[model samples]
Target: SGGLHGVGASVVNALSEFFLARSWRDGYEWTQEFSRGKPKSGLKKGKPTRTHGTMITFRPDPDVFSKTHFSYKTILAVSESKAFLNKGLKITVENKRDGEKPVTFRYNNGIQDYISRIVQGTTLVNQEPFYFEKEDDFKIECVVHWTIATDTEMHSYANSINTSDGGTHELAMKAGLTKAVRTYAERRNLIPKNIKSISPEDVYEGLYGIISVLVKNPQFQGQTKEKLNNPEINSPIDTAVKNACEAYLLANPTMADAVVKRVLLAAEARLASRAAKETVTRKLSSLKMNLPGKLADCSSNKVEDSELFIVEGDSAGGSAKMARDRKTQAVLALRGKILNVEQVASLEKIQTNNEIKNLLATLGCGVDQHFDLSKLRYGRVILMTDADVDGAHISVLLLTFIYRYMPGLISHGHIFLAMPPLYKIAAGKETFYAMDEMEKEKILAKLNGRKFDVGRFKGLGEMSPDILKETTMSPKTRTLMKVQVVDHKATGKVFERLMGKDPKARFVFIKERAEFAELDI
Candidate 1:
């Protein structure tokens, strides 16, 4: 399969302000230069050389691009993917801007090496990855490995180009693998009698696979080459992969049994998760008029006009309730530190926690996979905590829970953090609110030695109802930071290191960034 219809190089040259092309062939070096698609210099012979290769370098035209900078990580990932797709191919990437060391990516065993790298520390159901390659009218190569993880990770390629949206090839792969696993399990009587059947999702729960196909002419959905559109290749690829997987499973009974057992476990979890979700849904449905007992609900029934503030304690909750607009704003005061959802083993376990259940009920949006954005009760969910280290910790914990379960809250611009003042300064009867020490100092500096009184707030509970309404609760004067997820992969790693069960991970993380940390103590 080919991409860009042979216009890739020409397009790059056209978009580049400065372009240089060098070629070594016929025992001589030839060079050419171009600027904005127009030739600056004709092809010229430099010197006789033994090497025979082409090299092109170009700088993106600043006028054509708003931002001309390239991300090193993205480039490295694309380079590594190319190396993995073509076995024994070596790709080197160098970043001169940061003086970072150049890195080389080479995978001798191709996708098998990819699976090995991905599952390096992960527990595996299959010790060895199953690999098959067919070089014919359409070259097809695939590798699959099963792990103890709960999700599937698969990469599909069409002619070495990444196909992120998938299409016929990916569909074929899933069907083939599911068929192979189901047949093997049935033949060996590995599946339990009580369990009805194993689904495709069950078979792929812990599976990691890579599928690469090279067709003479491939049909892509768009210019991005995100999906394959060919219908004829599906049946042949499915049959080939199914036969290959069947033979491998028959040859290795131990691995086959392990795979089947993992699938069965996933199937069981699916049933249990479904039941748990149903129970939660039924219970929540019965509580239309019975919102959380502690919640002080707003008078308005219109979702868009309403807001909910999740306060830290009863003291703060009381202050917020007294300060809020009765028609638009509601308050829910959590008694203590809510459950640390990162440590919870399952969704069912999370549902069992009283505080979490109350919080979920208050939101009116179901948790986890059952979450519905349309069912959300409030237009905005504001976390109004104290301006201190403990408050920050509580906010992080709450964010972890929301990110894991109701990600739509953050992604859809519904989640926000209330920026309450830490210090209130009165200079000659003119009052000023400061969010932190820096703001307080700036305020003092501007006072210019005038007689003033500075009051430091211990927490939101310490602030008066009138002051809270004026500075923190009123939409006209208050500052709220919208929660957003910029890089979800990095965010997940941070959450795992800080809130995950392993204390050592937190220690290591703190140690690594200790120099940059500003300890309040």
Candidate 2:
């Protein structure tokens, strides 16, 4: 695994305190043992077995690495990538730590199967992924598809080495595909002469593509081989891909039409977004820009020190404003439930929404390719809602927006949720704010028969400004759950099912998980 990981066979051996290698070939067995990279025993005879494969086992030296444990998921993922790159290759992964059954991945169709596997749960424009491979001069292989979801993913490789920060090879692939699609669409009279030609950005919207390039003398950007910079390799690969795509579309009219339609939609959105961005920029320049009137201003000019809270209502916003440090904390209250962006079709419509527009203006980070975290006004953006059914719904809606559009916010660890108390218990001039029933019960037990005044807050509006400051707004006392996306596909699937347009899927999801849901009232 080159760019895939930092580990290697010799490196592993050198860092291992104990190592063993066993090989069974041609009905004979051979074994060697090592300790701390030094061979303890020469090749020796071992028990014969039917299998003719080699096995290496090693225990890492504690002196070498801070952590000695292995990750099953990481191993499996690398193995899967290998199997995908090499057609007709079979790889089996096993993790004995958790007593789980072993799993094998064998792909006869190579990257096409890889694409199919990746897009299994997501809605596909076509059941089969678009694929092309050429072995002469320079080997170039590619598999691509469009998903119903918004995110676009690209993975490139050079001689089986995963180029995470792809270079010229990936660029060629993108250019080739864009040209091929535009050529086909123009020939098919799909686009009007008045409209602008489809650019790579437009074509890549909702696209999922995987590529691997093999060259005799591959030039890499660095010692780690994070990217391929071979100049000679681009044209040949591009021509091959372009030819393959042209032939594919000519052969499959239905799929070609579907692909063209998706590309056209992407083009429309891109144009619409450009216009909206221009308008927003002009407004901001004029200093008469539209932001949420309810948003309380922060005195701080430093980006790192500022924080923004998207509260549920005006009542909470007012309290939060009074409770906030003023120099750092800003608050913006929602007018009502926001449009579930997952269900929205047009990017223009979403931009036109007052709530979303205000957020974009205030945050200074645009969506999609236009987004820049450096321009973000606040270091932290927290969602503050009540601890009830409506609050939960609002939270999910806001989370969906952030997850789909400003995914980088979560990735950079800037998104958070403020945990305000649900109950206030007062007894003999002493008061405690409880987040849930468990805390309330504990407080009650402590008070015993002291006769305390117990009040359950229906929403954040019920809390006084001082109480709000003490329990939720103050950085010293507040409990903020920092949101993170550990798994993209799993998280995307959840948001899709919950916020997507498909009611049947939502019904099934609710039906399956209904028992675990707690009712507040």
Candidate 3:
């Protein structure tokens, strides 16, 4: 039996070479087969089976896919997400090829359990999660919690499908939370004497929440169920969550106290960060603080025409600075590894780090809420690090910083990772730069089985200034991957899992998807 009721299985079947669906209905079992969305055989009556369920098996068409093999881990992740949303549903996925045991996932606590799992590494302001379920001709349930971690994660769903793009329900929840928090803060004197009122942004600093709504007719914004579009459900959800949260806070004084304290701390930090940003602005306005002494900035004032390359070490930086075009490319050479801002609290503290300070100055945009996209000095912020494990780690750390503090940069498609060719295949006068195995094979094929001398480039430092420019730095030849946030909450969860101080959560995450990992020697 298989839990294959949604869009995925049908889509999978449509694109597959062979698909078989076995179903047990009433007192009998039946089987059917299809090939490329066409029915190969009609439903055949089978002997009565004791089991009451369905089983679907599909092999993807090789011609239709880059690779026909399916990722077992990807399927498991999808199943796990489904299991989290559905409270009582038991989902099991198995990789039958390797004799691997099936993975069982069943969450009785639903989204509440999911919240706990998500914030495993975080320091909670309120240990007891706020959960409420209400039904009045409609169904809506919400689970929310406040954490000391200075990141917000809010996920919404309609009929168990993730609404990553958000819709009416999400907007309503945000509005309700904003209103409720503001009202509660004002009433309880949670706001500091000097500060006026807490903004919605300030209040959501350390919040983690989940909202799930079940509707008879779900109006999805896209085919992918990226967003919910039912505007009618907004008022009902707002009322339910608002009333429930207000009552819960009033009843639980101790928990309310904790929440208020955390929010107040966030407010204070917000104020401090703003003040720091103002100071930076004042300094920049008053003093002529030139770009990093090591950097060779481009002449282009138009952000659209400019690209910034964040290179590792002064050696690579120097070469890049010399090699890059003066009119469009700016080189910022990092002396050492940057501060892993995931664990840091004060933005001021983060600003104190030499590398980060230089970066902040070079970028011309402040961090956190104070970050002004208009102030960005370059349109393309490319991370051009050594092609090694250390480079990858550095890139991840930089990404974490940007994601946590400068998310708008990513959202606006300003951030990019420069892909440098790994190997240079040369035969006689012919030379080929191969980025990966596939590219290498293509190049080899083009050579008509000619024996080629392969040269593996270890790092950026090894490459000459011309080679570096030709392979990575040159806009015409460079391969840059733009950073995109598909799901902000999912992205936040990944950062929380990988960079946070939770060994158990990291272990579980890695163990569950270990097979999918492409390890370097």
Candidate 4:
């Protein structure tokens, strides 16, 4: 509603190569046809019909657009959202291009149905969503529920259009919810004595909420409609949300207590995280002369030239250090898998692990909130493990730690996985390496029946310094997969399911995907 104004149909019609419209109204069917924005046929009356809607069919001009394909899933999602926003409204979508089945979206409970779907499988602080709708200057419908998660999820819409870049309405909603929760907690003296105060960040940590407002004339920031810019709608929305939340909390004492406890726990975790960050900063500031003893430091002080190779075992570390260019390449050998930060309860607990401590000290960049990319000692942080299942597991463990603690490394493209060769082939004087079984077979096929010696490396420990350098450590010859986070939410969910404390989640995941798993045996 806020996105395209009233000219969306006209614009689409103008941009289409072929456009056909059929309308059933006033006991008659009317039809019109247009080609390339010009009328091909005048509006013609057809057989009498009792229907009361318009049907438009159009083919996008391939000459005007780079691509003219439509995604059925994307259209269905928008239809579902619209149905959820407007209660009892039914929207149907069908894709004839790909022969997709028709889908009908209708929700009776409006945004409450949306909240139910979001919190379906998660641990909940609120048994049911706290829902309320009010009308003043602008109609506001808000629903909220609290989960046991450490992260917050909130969706705000203006005039049925998603406001992803939240504007005045979102800000007001947050303020109102924060005020309500804080007031309730303070009234009941639910806050712990150890906790000084709670911030909005704490109260909304695990909150899942949907705020939908119907504005007569919504002022959007841009053509995208990602944000609502109307400042006048703030006060009404704020008051409505505050009053609704306050009333709900007052009526549901048990839910209120649960919410308060959840908020306090979040506050405590926030405080501990701040303290851990401070501790790391203090240590990093003081420990310039005391890099980890296991780290084979490079001669180059230039961050752009320096590399840190996190090798799997001491043997591999030794070989990497021996083969490395001492001016730019440094190696730090981890004994085995490091602590899984996803399973850990707190950042303080992560700091206590010996392997993690050594890593934090070696990197120079502070952990968590105190992380500074400018202070990093290395341009590249490579994970060089064996080319096997065990090595992949170890790499995953290390990645989990890095993802939870120093995500900046992955985000900034400083993290990489070194591709070590698993098989070594010698055809007379020429030597070649293969990373996997498929690669080895391909290489053998290319050899054309020539007699050759094939050796399978059990681990990186088995590789000589020269071989290891040639395959993995050398920048010019080696293949490195740069670790990146394309989708933060999806990646985080994967880590949670795999490395989290919930064994049941991991079990279910493994069971579902066991058929596709490749056995190292």
- Which one is best on TM-score? 3
TM-score of 2: 0.59
Candidate 1 vs candidate 4, TM-score winner: 1
Off by over 4 Å in 1: 1-16, 23-53, 60-69, 279-367, 371-492, 498-504, 510-521
Candidate 2 per-residue lDDT, tens place, 1-521, comes to: 55323446777788899999989997878999998879999999877667788889999896664334576766887898899899999898888887889999888988988777777777888566778888997788998897666678888999998776688899998889898999999999998654678888878878888999888988888666778899998898788889898898889889888988888888887777788788867766674355668788799989889999998778877788888898998988888888899999887798889888788878887776667888888999999999777888998999998888888788767899888888889998899888877778877887878989889898888888888989998888788888865446778888989889999999998989999687788
Which runs of model 4 end up more than 4 angstroms from their true locations? 1-11, 23-32, 38-50, 64-68, 278-521
Q: TM per model?
A: 0.62, 0.59, 0.68, 0.58
Q: Which tens-of-lDDT digit does each residue in 191-262 have in candidate 4?
A: 888898879999789988888888888888877677888889888777888988999999999989999899
Worst 10 residues of 1 by lDDT: 62-71
Q: Which candidate ranks first by lDDT, i.e. highest?
A: 1
Question: Any runs in candidate 2 off by more than 4 Å, and if so which?
Answer: 3-15, 21-54, 62-69, 121-123, 126-128, 147-149, 222-224, 283-365, 373-403, 408-487, 494-521
Ranking by TM-score: 3, 1, 2, 4
lDDT of each: 0.88, 0.84, 0.81, 0.86
> How do the residues 51-112 of candidate 1 rate in per-residue lDDT, one tens digit apiece?
99899999999667523557787788778888988999999999998899999999998988
Comparing 2 and 3 on TM-score, the stronger one: 3
Deviating ranges (above 4 Å) for candidate 3: 1-75, 96-99, 121-127, 135-138, 148-150, 159-167, 181-202, 214-232, 261-277, 284-309, 313-355, 372-380, 393-397, 400-416, 427-450, 460-521
The 10 consecutive residues of candidate 2 with the worst lDDT sum are 1-10
Tens digits of per-residue lDDT for model 3, 427-455: 99977787665666767877887889988
Model 1 scores what on Cα lDDT?
Answer: 0.88
- State the TM-score for model 1: 0.62
